[model samples]
Target: MMFRLESVDARQYRHKSKRVGWTMAALLLVFGLAFSQLLVQSFGSSFWLNALGVLLGLLATSLIFAWWRRRPDMAEVRYVTRLKQHLARVSAHLSTLRQASRQGDVRALDLLAFYHQGMAQLETLEGRTMDDDAERLAERLELRKQRQLHGLPEEVAGFDPAELDAFRRSEPRT
Candidate 1:
């Protein structure tokens, strides 16, 4: 699988790579020493056997290290996966809001608010602009709002505090 290091810091990448490299080297060294000792005992200090063991050990270590170095660190993988999932959720929510708005439903206004909140969350998470979808939704919401207001009398165009109080009083208290 393809791996990306773009989300990870350079220093952290180097530190983790070094730690893995050292751990692998230590394990190889221990294995090489034990194997060489066994070879010597079996063959009575044969020069060729000892040399072959060292050569194979070095080759294996190099190959493993190269493979490990090419792979992305675990932390970076998790971070990128999380970011993708979050963006997917944001896109889905925006699409739902757009559909609701197209139907001219009054409840679209509340869903639009939720869409804006999701965009704000995306912006904060990525430290970048997430306003494209939100801006489109805002324009559609504004048009709907104006159309709704045009159909209403001036006296009923604004919020009614008495209505809010009545609704709140009707709700059962926890």
Candidate 2:
């Protein structure tokens, strides 16, 4: 199956959030700093100092917030979030999927995808990126594709306990 970083942290969802945050902060700061521009333009007051202050404040606040992201321990937070999502993904179907995997059923690929993503999430929490196991699996899959999966079902609409178990009972149980 084609997969890439299926297990990413909740933070990945917030990737564009930082830009939005910066834009909002800049807007708020700029609104406040507008007073300086007003002073400079209308009153002919010496607002150069205020202009510098506004510039400095914007840059400094941006840098400070960026650095603060490193201060808190978000490892557990991200892990818990990922765990919840994974649970939601496989909670009802986990056992059936496992049985499917043990039976060498093509439906097992869905199970593998779930685990592959979970591992990736764990790796991310550890300051790691890619799942090496997944890399190897992908490589093997690529090599195996030429041979083709000899007996995949014509239509796999994902796993269901009843559907998978019906076939599981027919297997030799080796």
Candidate 3:
């Protein structure tokens, strides 16, 4: 089952449950050790020290175990944030391309190249960008090509229009 902390009541319940569970476990452990120590000190000799030693050792091991369990959450949050930022950067580059293209600036070609490179990297990172957006981008590039027939012709440049169509077809719809 998925744990949803989306609502205030759910968040409160999780917080309270976690606090109660940890508190109860700690109290039980402390009482267990205290009882063991008292029994050993009263009914045995030189064994309360050993009991205390064992209790302390278990406490240390439990702490290490808890840290191990919690460490992955931190790592996952870090990577997810990084991936989100990377996606934003790619989108920003695409925006730069669009703006430069609108201004009829020659540098827009360079920006378009950079945007394609960024998209390639994003594809490798998570492949999560919307397929429709990619198709629109490819269509826009095709329109730009027809408008500015100044670049090398597709035949002489060994550029296959079919490849662009193939890429659009291969992507999954959003």
Query: Where does candidate 2 have its weakest 10-residue lDDT segment?
Result: 152-161
* Residue 88 accuracy (lDDT) in model 2: 60
For model 3, how does the per-residue alpha-carbon lDDT over 2-75 read when each residue is reduced to its tens digit? Answer: 11111123344345446546865775576557656766676775665657656765676567546744564334
TM-score of 3: 0.29
By how many angstroms RMSD does model 1 differ from the true structure?
Answer: 16.4
lDDT of 1 by residue, 1-174 (tens): 111113345455445646876878886896677667778888878788888767767777778766765575546434444445544543554555455455654444343433344344435444566456776666646745744654622122222234333433543354
Q: How many residue pairs clash in each candidate?
A: 0, 0, 0
Assess the local accuracy of residue 27 in candidate 3 as a C-alpha lDDT between 0 and 100.
58
Between which residue pairs do clashes occur in model 3?
none
> lDDT values of the candidates?
0.52, 0.51, 0.47
Each candidate's TM vs. the true structure? 0.33, 0.28, 0.29
* C-alpha lDDT of residue 97 in model 1: 43
**TM-score head-to-head 1 vs 2, winner:** 1
Per-residue CA lDDT of model 2 for 32-68, tens digit only, reads 4775675567767675757765776666667765665
TM-score of 1: 0.33
* Local error of candidate 1 at residue 135 (angstroms): 46
Which segments of candidate 2 are over 4 A away from where they belong? 1-104, 129-135, 138-172
lDDT-wise, the better of 2 and 3 is 2
